[model samples]
Target: TLFVPEGIDDPEIEPGYVERAFATASRMTPFWTEKSRQAHDIQVRSGTFAVTMDGAPIFGPLPGVPGLFVNIGYDGHGVMCSIEGARRLADLMAGDAEHDPKDPFAAERFLDGSNPIPEPMTIHQVQ
Candidate 1:
């Protein structure tokens, strides 16, 4: 679900948004095509704020924090990139030949203070 700000919470009933969306839809140039596949029955929540240094995802063993594993910080690309990311991370943990080096996604990079591009990574907007 898209998290609308407090003022725009009820977009259906909200005056300005209702008119704007109606006008935009009437233009007949939708941004994305409608999906035709059967829906995968699952519950999902959208408020995930995992930050990493390179803005790329971190998907491997939790460094220095032993016994804890993590496959996180895909930013907004988690749904699209998760399949490969999970495979690579699993390979790393299993010490398999297919495991790519985890240097690019090291959690330590966060400590080095390199900021992700297109900054202010939080999805929450400040008024």
Candidate 2:
């Protein structure tokens, strides 16, 4: 049940979103039975977020801001990588020696001219 309100920057959940959600679910999946929909209690949640230029995470220290580390722009995989990502960022902040030299998620890539080519936007790849 992915509800992506396109071009919406407002963090507040809009009115009638629950109805639209159920409708989209039903339309996209045959498994969303009437019984299931009727038995469900809908609760809406919303927030604002930013996406990186290349649709990948921007982790580690922010350039020109000493001691300010960031771990943002995970696209939609924050839940999947939160634990590992946090550990990596913490290690880097603590001056640990085990940090990867070629860290792919480094924030400097945006400024260092090493950013990967941006992918073509699609419905499933919205960022």
CA lDDT, candidate 1, residue 126: 31
Scored against the true structure, residue 70 in model 1 reaches a CA lDDT of 73
Deviating ranges (above 4 Å) for candidate 2: 1-20, 27-29, 39-43, 98-102, 112-116, 119-127
Q: How much is 15 displaced in model 1, in angstroms?
A: 7.2
Clashing pairs for predicted structure model 1, backbone only: none
| lDDT scores in order | 0.58, 0.70
Per-model TM values vs. the true structure: 0.53, 0.63
In terms of lDDT, model 1 sits at: 0.58
Can you write out model 2's per-residue Cα lDDT over 1-127, one digit (the tens) per residue? 3586654665667788777666788788866658446756766667655677777787787778888888888667678866788888888888884444367787767776665766454133524
For residue 74, give model 1's deviation from the true position in Å: 1.5
Q: How well is each residue in 1-127 modelled by candidate 1, as lDDT tens digits? A: 4566643433234335434544566567543122212224433223435645445787776757776657887767688877888887777778783423436665655665656464355343435
lDDT of 2: 0.70
